[model samples]
Target: MIDQELTKIKSSTVLVTGGAGFIGSNLCENLLNNNISVVCLDNFSTGKLKNIQPFLNNSKFTLIEGDIRNLEDCHKACENVDYVLHEAALGSVPRSINDPITTNDVNVSGFLNMLVAARDAKVKRFVYAASSSTYGDHEALPKVEDVIGKPLSPYAITKYVNELYADIFQKTYGLDTIGLRYFNVFGKRQDPDGAYAAVIPLFVKQFLNHESPIINGDGSYSRDFTYIDNVIQMNILAITTTNEAALNTVYNVAYGDRTTLLELATLLKKHLVSLDESIANIEIKHRENRAGDIPHSLASIGKAKKLLKYNPQFNISDGIKEAVNWYSKNL
Candidate 1:
């Protein structure tokens, strides 16, 4: 889609709200690679300076240190921006469970602030990161966008509220919007040191150091485990699509496959073994299941493929191998 679809945004300027973070930094880098001017707004709460440091010297890349929880910051970031890719949020089930107040402040209230700023700025499109957590207690395989269950956690509630606010923003204020429900996005630059670190990078880091990585449950739980590039494709398509029917809706951004926790850990170990033979001997351990944790998560990407031409290029094996390689060298 790069030489074709992404060409549409080549002349446009994009504002990545969390451009110092993992997924946001990747998006910012991709846009800058295409010679598209990018303005990055981040407070470095969960974002890191190292992530955006490489782009600091680029003339086309601009960094605005600001928080999404502040409306002035949102307004300033949206100014003269052609499109907004909102990726700023507090992400993690346990984090929200520990402090629902801060989660709602950033995810729900901050999301609304961005919506209003985007509307007033008259940006062409507002594309934000939604999550599969919205699938919640719904016991279904290959989660579809239209169907959803009650939120299983405070973080899930906040993300669901983002979708609702986006929908109302479009209907009430004529602001076009699209939500990409990201599933387990992991890749280079993803932090492995946080208490809320995602499973993939965290596991890869532990294996690199010959530390046993813990599985939250008895290893029966599963996830779609999407790659960062697939997510980048979905975000680009969300902004560039000319399909009138695609706007004001949500789409699942995933590789459309699932891997059990046991399978995922084994996959990580297998790939990291190449870096250090000792990594093979590292044991995989398990404990009680995490609260707000679902047994499985899978996404049906039919909506994205049909509407946005989103074709995921990485499967679990391919994604894990790439992630392991990057972390081995960078982590």
Candidate 2:
């Protein structure tokens, strides 16, 4: 069972891989908000320094430009780090489909490098960004940790591989580790212009510019879109948890609710319209579904609830509302 007040480690030193990306940057902010010392590492493959520019001068923070795929870089970043939050990866199924070699190099080889560095450096705990895509082709309504399906894409395979490697590390190397299989996470600082950008940010940007946002299918596919804050909470919990049962396992981190693409567009339009009424009439176009895209995804976070005392505070609508507000202010 999870303790209500998890054991708090002295945040004297912490390293976050991909700390300049959407979810990673949010985690960095929350840790800093708690007065924790943060060491951020990124190769700028997708992460931008501007995302974490506010923390540049903070005495508690240090930025290291490094690639996780390189063992030397990982070793340098892991030096004296108390906790390691691994979030570096080339995300998005379409992107992986377009370039499987790059995705494999970053998500697999890079992840392994980070794990080796954490182990060699004797870090307290390793917490990595897993994905709901690990649930893959399962037709299950609510995804659970124990049950899984065939991987549907290169991206999904890589995440599942992360969990597998983490488990192996625990058994073989006596390394403490935890994996959070995050659902579709979105919030402030999510880049809205990339070819592989997430749905919420991209749609918000398009709506802001009065451009038609394309829905991959007929707009009926659904997802359990989680918030970045919730993901941060899970990382904090995973790193802080002292429960032996929870230390070496993977948990679903999500809002436990599903929303369809059509419903998502509707909600985005409503939020954008409230901010700027001119966006109300923005159209959403539909096309053939993209390959490697899951039809529907919803996570069963019971394991997280029981093991990590995980509590998610945002659903899709609330998250969307917050994300829209951020984009409105930032973009």
Candidate 3:
């Protein structure tokens, strides 16, 4: 079904901003694999050159080394594009907290630039990478789309603002938009050597090196750790779904299951030890919880399933296994 939908748009071009980043690069690869034309725009601030190096030689792949903060760059990438997958942003809550101004400048101002570029280019759809952090202090067990609380961090505010702007763009300018609220996504190509690196990849790399993995706050914090493939499916569905009800709305792109930090470390160790038995002796440490960290995060993927026919193929365990294998070979 995904292939059939993509086949319909094979003749069309997709402009993926931040295409050198983890999720963006994966999207670019999947689109190119499907014989779809892809234009990748990246500034390499957080996105690495190695991530998209494989696609550099592909005839269907076009790389625009530029920043989205500049509207001209956005315009250049959107030229002749049929659809837009806006993945460019300064991710990480701690990074945003340290420098809210830069985060807002790139996430909010840059997002607006892409919206205008896509609108002016007359693209069929504008799908963007929203964040589950938008759930904020809502304290809901299963986060639904409509009910959201005050944003807990600067990153959350920027993501929620993206949704608001997308709604206004659709209502006022007649541009179709879809916002995908991604949960704790992790997989191959994800950077594990950074201060703002995600937990799964960070832990995987630590285990591989025989270093102790740290668990914050007694390891009770849980997340709906979705895999990259599931996120890719959500993006494809957002752009290709024929259902009118699915258009101009936000959907949670997650696995619909939660795993605590302790559980996650245990699982990673279990998977990694299979490759190297000595890793089993690596101890897990604990520390105080970080500020603005949510106690638990689990998404209600019912809207995505009902509207976009999203069927997530990998759960946390399966995703961890694949990610562990990749990190073992790559790291």
Compared with the true structure, model 2 gives a TM-score of: 0.97
Off by over 4 Å in 2: 1-7
List ranges where model 3 is wrong by over 4 Å. Answer: none
The Cα error of candidate 1 at residue 117, in Å, is 0.6
Note the Cα lDDT for every prediction shown.
0.92, 0.89, 0.93
Q: What is the lDDT of residue 91 in candidate 3?
A: 95
Best-performing candidate as measured by lDDT: 3
Query: Residue 326, candidate 1: how far off, in angstroms?
Result: 0.6
| Model 1 C-alpha lDDT per residue in residues 33-120, reported as the tens digit of each score | 8888999999999999999888999999999999989999999999999999999998999999999999999999999999999999
Better of 2 and 3 by TM-score: 3
Q: Total clashing residue pairs per candidate?
A: 0, 0, 0
Error of 2 at 234 (Å): 0.6
Instruction: For model 1, give the 10-residue run with minimal summed lDDT.
Output: 1-10
Q: lDDT per residue, candidate 3, 89-206, as tens digits? A: 9999999999999999999999999999999999999999999999899997899999988888999999999999999999999999999999999999999998999998899889
lDDT of 2 by residue, 1-331 (tens): 1123323665457799999998889888888877888999999989998999999999999999999999999999999898999999899999988899999999999999999999999998999999888888889889988889999999999999999999999889988999989898989999988678889899998998899999998999998899887888898888887798888888999999999999999999998898788888877899999999999999898999898888888878888888888899998
Q: What's the TM for model 1?
A: 0.99
